[model samples]
Target: MENRDVARLLRETARLLELRGENPFRVRAYEQAAEAIEQLDEPVAERVRQGTLTEVPGIGRGLAAQIQELVERGTSEMLERLRQELPPGLPELLTLKGLGPQRVRQLWQTLGIASLDDLEDALRDGRLNQLKGFGPRLHEQLLHALSLRRRYRALRLLAQVLPEAEALRERLRQQPGVIRVELAGAVRRLMEVVDRVELVVAGSAEAVQQVLPQLRQQSGLHGGMLLEGALPDGFPVRVALTTPDAFGTVLWWHTGSEAHCRTFVRTYGAPEPCPEEATIYEQAGLPFIPAELREDRGELEAAAHHALPALIELEDLRGVLHNHSTYSDGRNSLREMAEAACNRGFRYFGTGDHSQSLTIARGLSIAEVRRQQEEIQTLNEQFAARGFRILSGTECDILPDGSLDYPDDVLASFDYVVASVHTRLNMDEKTATERILRALRNPHVTILGHPTGRLLLRREGYPLDWPRIIDACATYRVALELNANPYRLDIDWRRVRDATAAGVPIVINPDAHAIDELDHVRWGVAAARKGWLTPEACLNARDLDELLAWLHQRRQSVQP
Candidate 1:
């Protein structure tokens, strides 16, 4: 089994133990082991083979034995026993945002709410409302979570599914008689969440048919042309079979917004057999439109007038901002993260570790903040000789009343501050908007981080007057963050164009918690491109000197 698979089992075991009211230490042991395995650079299976699994930190002999069992048998007796002991769907309750093991236990024991369906039943019958701790706000939040769960149940985050999809596409390409393979649909459009992984395959019908049964949970081909199946992980996948001559037409048809395809047919007529995708656009008497902009969001009109945006690419970014380090909940230390950014050709790295209000992340206290800034100063001294610099920053919480976490003096000490809302997320639209507007008015808030706290496919962003928020950002000179964390790519791409058009610079922040996650900026860049962002409009696209000047200017503006 892969490390992630083993880690998942271990984590589920931890959660199950927590739900069962087992010893807290035992539960933490499992949780720590899972974290250790997940962060290992090498495979746990290999360590198990070497009989050195226990040598790894956090993996005791007892846990190693369980890991061995999981690796060899693809299942653990302990996990199976735990599963059998609980209601089969009890664990699924944890998938809801606010429902931790404690709350799930409360629901299960207090109201017999063991599953989403049971929770829904309780909500319908008003049993949930009668529960002691189920307040009106919690009730509304639960309803929203359930609604999001139902609406986005079929979709998967692009980052979560893209690697699997690409690997599957490559495997199909190696099949005998297959001529070519191109990914299409939402995957091609670079949508943050996708419902299906679609591909256009150039090959013989017989050759394509030969590979159908190999895939899991397949529906037989429709009209001997389209094959539908689930990837090994059960993400929905579809393949359109065509000859090399008609590859472009099939790809264009499958890689659609439905509206884009209909608009094209209405304006230019049905596409003819063309092997090149660009040729399809050329034949339509327009410039080649990028797949990311083919949402019928005026891309065709833009192309007609040669007005397509030279969308920002990943290479345009010269630094990373709003990142975490070991000073907070980040897995990597400050030096490690900064060095990793430097290795990736970034000239500057901004450490936006959690501020004091966020205890869950071990947010920095005043003393800790001073110590971290001293370390940053020391590191800057060493890095200066190497032409790299680390910026002292904080992901300062926007308090319930919309005030910044640190007082003005401490806030001014940082090179920049990413003001974000991390608590009291159930606010109504006007309240949320005003809360954010107040943060924007704070001169210390250099960038508005993840303008919405939405976790894609898991929870919807709380309601907000977005136009007002954008205008407030423009007026206050607060750059809006396109948070690069795949799950929370907030300041959603749909709103990015409006924000940028109103002269608000979009800062694509990885919100990186580890060295490896620094690459997450690519996903944010993809979403940014879809939003028509240009390098000139991207905050991190500025060079180190320009970034320093911008930060210094902001500080100056706030001065007496």
Candidate 2:
């Protein structure tokens, strides 16, 4: 079994247990185990085979045994028994944005609402609001959440699908007759969410035909047609079979926005055999456009003029930003995070613990903030001898009234501030835009965190006139963050070019809560590349001295 599959089963078990009124600690344990498995670099199945499953953090002997059973037998008896006890739709209800286990239980017991449709019916009939905690605001939000859920039902996060797609590509490459495999479509474009995985296989049609049956019978593949396949979970996979000579043409054709392909055809006629993608573009008398830029967004014209910007690379980043530690919701301590960042070749680390409004994250009190600052100062001194720096920062909340959570004096104490909206996310576009603008105007705010508050497929961001937000960031000289967490790659790539064009600097922040999460910067860099940002346009790509100087300059610009 894939680690993701095992993680999903464990998570499902936790949710089912919650629905059954199991002990809170037990539910939390399962949830933690699931998290540990999801973040695991090596497969749980491999660990099980090695008899080292218990060595994984959060996986005790009991959980390790369960994982081994699930991995070896392909099913967990405990999970199946829990499924038998709860209404099947009860698990689906837990997916709604605001519906926690307790709320789901209330709906089930108080109103017999076990499914989304049932909850919607209760809302329509005014029965839902009659419950103790249900209110008009939450009712409306739930409805919106359901709509978003339905709209994005088939889409999977890029992080989830990329690994699966790559694995399938590797398997295809191993097939006897497959010459080469290249990902195409939105997956190639590095879109944040994609509904299907598309690939092009280079080999003769006869060779492809010979290998087709064996390919379909591979593990994890359920149903497949001549050129289409499905995973056990029903994710669609589309493939184009072609000869090695036409590999580039096939890849280019399938890795397209219709407009891009049409423009290519109009400019250069139909695709013909070419050894590589660069050759096809060369034949068309244009520079080779990166796959991420093949979006029909004036890229062809730019390539024709040899004017494409050098996209930002992962190695261009010199520092890590907006990271959390034990001062807040983070699992790692300040020193550990700093050490990890340095080990990863970063010259500096910014500590952005939650500020006083997000109590659930253990937001720092004024006294706590001061203490953290002192700790950072000591660490900086210790690291200074080695030419490394740790910057004291805070992910300060932008309150409902558009004011910051910390007073001016308190905010000034930090080397940088990442102003973000942690609550009141349902505001209208104007209010949301204005609130963010007010925060941007704060001279101390170095970066705007996850500018839209989006959580990938889970919740839609508060609506905003993004063009205006970009203009404001530019005017205020504030850097907009491309939050690197897979769940919240906000300041979405689609809007990244707008920010870059407006001369707004983009900061690729992992927003990491743990040391391992620091690796999310790679995803952030990919998102930036998709948006056509170059190293020159990214704040994090600046060297330590240059970065600190820029921060000092921004602060001084606002001083009297």
Candidate 3:
């Protein structure tokens, strides 16, 4: 097995043990072993065969034995035994935000709620609230979680499915007659979540028949189906076999949204054989639409009018913002982060560590903030001759009462601020909207971070009237952050168009906690393209001088 596969098995084992109330240290050992194995350059199986698995940190004698068994036998008796003891669906409950092992165990032991169905039934019958820790707010949050889980039950994040899909495509390409392969469906559109992966392959029926048996032997493919099937791990996949002549037409049909395809058929009749997707669009008398804009959201008409915006590209960004350092919860030191940004060709870097209210993130105290600023000043001196800039910033939390974590004077001391809501996310629409509006009204607040507070597929963002919030952002001249963390690509792309149309600047920030995460800017750029954002609409797309000027202008305009 691959190192990733072994790591997954170990992590799953750890999670199951946690749910079963196993010894804390033992469970932690498995978790750490999984992480260590994942980071190893070589396969864990090779390490096991070398009799050096125990040399790896966190892999004790007992854990090494488990790894050996899993590698040699393809299964762990201990893991299987634990699975047999627990409810089959209990592991799925852990995927829900805020429902950790402790709460899941509480529900399982007290209410016999094992599956999502059982939990839903208990919630409807009012039995969920009878437990010790189930308060009214918790109950509401659980209901919201259940609703979101149901809506996205079969969907996996785009990042989670892309690697597997690419591997499958490569496997298919190796077949005797397969000439070309292209991924389609939600994956091609780069949706935040995908339900199934689709592929269009160009080949002959005879070649396809010859390759079907070989494909079945590959991992993740279900037997008994030649043209369509699901991964044994539950990822659905559909493969469309076509001739080279019809490949483009088939790909176009599969790539466009259902609504777009229907509209195309209505307007242009059935699609004709074309050499490429652009050919089909030209035949339909429309300009070529990008895959990201294929949603039936007026792209066809916009293309006909030749008015599509030149979407923002990754290279357009000049600096990184809302980044974390060791002064807060980030893993890297301030110099490390700044140097990494410079290495990535960024002209500047902004430090946005957590403020005092978010104790969980080890938020910086007032004194800590001053110390961090001093360190940033020192780092700036080191890079001064290099023409790279570092800006002092903070991710100051927006309290429940619509106040920032830092006072106005303290906030103004920074070059910029990213005000965000880190807690009390269960507020009503009115309260949530007002809370954000108040934060935006603060002249010291430069960018609003992850405006929705939603973790993709985990928790619903707090309720808010987005139009009102967008209007307030424009009125207050507060830039909205397109937080680039894949999990929290907040200020959702759908709302980005509204913000852009209203002339509110959008800032694409990795919200990077580690240097590697600086690459998340690519995902943010993809999301920005989907939102029809252009370089002109993004604040970070400006050069170092222009960015500094804009910051100075905003600060001067808002000065007391």
Candidate 4:
């Protein structure tokens, strides 16, 4: 198992133990082992393979055995047994933002509330007020948190769902007489989170009937031409069967946004059955609209006028930026990360390891920053012959009062700075906007990192004044970051168009903490495409020399 998976199980085990009122010492041990494993520079699986898991601090012999079992079996018997002993929905309650095991246990024991539904009923009936700390404010917060949890929990990230969808498609493609299988719904649009997996399958009647048995195994509801069900993992799925001649029309019906489909049907009678999707668009007297542009947000009007933009593609990126290394919280060393980036054909790589003030991430001290710069200079010399450059940068913290974590001199030493807010994320909208605006005015800040401070499916992005933030970036000549991490595709894609329209360039950053994470740039590119980003509007799309020239010009423009 990966270290993260291992750590997550250990942590959950600890929480479950706490919820069950188990021995305090045992719970602490699990918690400690989880923390140690999370911070390890190497994979726990490696240690398990080496038979040295017990050598790690806080990992006792018993804990090591459990971890070994977890790695080998993908689960723990003890955890399973414990889960069986508790209310099934109790573990889910722990996922709420402010509800801890202690509070959850209190609710369970005092009010007999085990599930979210039970909790909601209690909240409505005033039974939650019986607890010492369950006041009106806490009750209201729980209601809000519960709503968000339900909304997010129903959806899964694109990265998580796409592979499974593709596998399903391949499985169906193998069916005899199956002609085609095209993804539809949110998956086709590349939405960050998908509510369900929808597919359009064109095949002979016998082949389509064969597919029904597979859906039936999932306990799906099968109608005349539709099969709706969920994967074994409970992700909802639907399959619509069609003949080969009507494949294009069926795909269009499944793929277009509700609004876009409505507009199309109203403007040009219903689309006729055709073999090609492009033909449908042609019949409507409009150019073929890309799937990502089917949001009906002026896309139809734009297509009518032939003013569609050429969206940025994965191949358009010239450099990978805002990455981290072992100098901070990253697993890989500086040289390893740089070599990986160079091998990937990027002309340049920007290292934006966390700066001091974010201790949780092992943010770099000023001395370490200088040491890293020295290493970067040495690597540049070694890479010179290969036409590669390693740009020294920092993901500097934007302090609450609108000042950067580093002094002006320290910040200026780096080739660029990605100022981010790692703390004080609960500020009011006006305060948050002003804080980011102040950071934008800092000459050394080249990019605003993950401007929303959001973690998809977990935490909401702090509120912001988008128009003001976009205007400030345009005014300061600072680029905005589209952090490409699957968990945090912050600076939501919808706002990317706004910033770019205001002349602010969007820099698609992997925000990578390890070498493998550099590939996350593709996800950022997907989100950028949804925003109609173009190569000319993307900062990293520029070649190295052009990028350097722009950086130089930005510095000059901001200078007194």
Best by lDDT: 4
lDDT of 2 by residue, 1-560 (tens): 87768878888888899898999999999988987776565678789889997788888999999989888888799998998878888888888878999999999998899888898888888998779889888999898878887878889988889998888788778877778988998999898889988888875445554544323422211111237656668888777776677677778877877889899899888766775888888888888899988888889999888899999999999999899987887767899999999989899999999999898788999999999989989998899877789998999999998899999999999999999998988789999989988888888888999988989888888899888888988888899999999889988888888998899999999999888899998788878888999999999999999998999888888774
Residue pairs with backbone overlap in model 4: none
Q: lDDT tens string, model 1, 1-560?
A: 98778988999999999999999999999988987876665778999999999888988889999999999998899999999999999998899877899989999998888999999888777888767778887888788778878888788899987888788788878889899998999999999999988888898656655665544323323222777777666777788887788788888888878999889889888888888788999988888888888899988888888999999999999999999987887777899999999999999999999999898777999999999999999999989987899998999999988998999999989999999999999888989998988888898889999888998887778899988998888877789999999999998999989998899998999999888899999899989988999999999999999999987886787665
What are the RMSD figures for all models against the true structure? 4.0, 6.0, 5.9, 2.9
Kindly list the per-residue Cα lDDT of model 4 for residues 50-148, writing each as its tens digit.
999888988989999999989999899999988888899898898886799899999998888999999888988999877898888888888998889
The deviation in Å at residue 381 for candidate 3 is 2.3
TM-scores, all models, native as reference: 0.88, 0.83, 0.82, 0.93
Model-by-model lDDT, in order? Answer: 0.88, 0.86, 0.85, 0.89
Ranking by TM-score: 4, 1, 2, 3
Off by over 4 Å in 1: 1-14, 23-80, 97-103, 106-113, 121-143, 209-224
lDDT of predicted model 2:
0.86
Candidate with more favorable, higher TM-score: 2 or 3: 2
Any residue pairs clashing in model 3, and if so which? none
Q: lDDT score, residue 558, model 1?
A: 68
The window of 10 residues in a row where model 1 has the poorest summed lDDT is 215-224
397: Cα error in model 1, Å: 0.7
Clashes of each: 0, 0, 0, 0
Q: Write the per-residue lDDT of candidate 3 for residues 412-473, one digit (tens) a residue.
A: 78999999999988788999999999888888989999998988887778888988988988
